[model samples]
Target: MSNRVVQGRMVTPGTLAELIEGSPVLETEDITDADRPCPECDGDVIEVGYMPSVTEFVTGYKCQDCDWSDDDRE
Candidate 1:
């Protein structure tokens, strides 16, 4: 799992606990083999952690050279 910080604060602190306590545990199976391309640089998305808002899980990806993120997409 990956952790992200914005302005030195977590984007969604305690996201995992909220997911485990709210969403069904079985949902984890749905994303076990999924791979989403980076919306910015078309890099491989790496599993960061669970964030139901973005799928049942939210991922982060970076370009090897540019280090761009999905949010950084132009």
Candidate 2:
């Protein structure tokens, strides 16, 4: 898997997913560029799709330069 740098640290897909999820995940997709600016600092953003639990899927967004994160979860 291709690892990406976030907050100056290299992180794999699973690690990044956990970073955003605030816990371990069941599964994860490859990391991708979000093609969007960070809402907090205008930095570049990345995206990852993961299963936080068996019954839920979430598309998580996080900043590469700062502590900003969001997710598409209902």
Model 1, residue 50: displacement in angstroms?
6.4
TM, every model: 0.26, 0.94
Q: Give the lowest summed-lDDT range of ten residues in model 2.
A: 1-10
Taking the tens digit of each residue's C-alpha lDDT, what string does model 1 give over 30-52? Answer: 21212666566564443323344
For model 1, the superposed segments whose C-alpha errors exceed 4 Å read 1-34, 50-66, 70-74
**Candidate 1 displacement at residue 54 in angstroms:** 20
TM-score of 1: 0.26
lDDT of 2 by residue, 1-74 (tens): 46999999999999999999999999999999998899999999999999999999999999999999999977
Name the runs in model 2 displaced over 4 angstroms. none
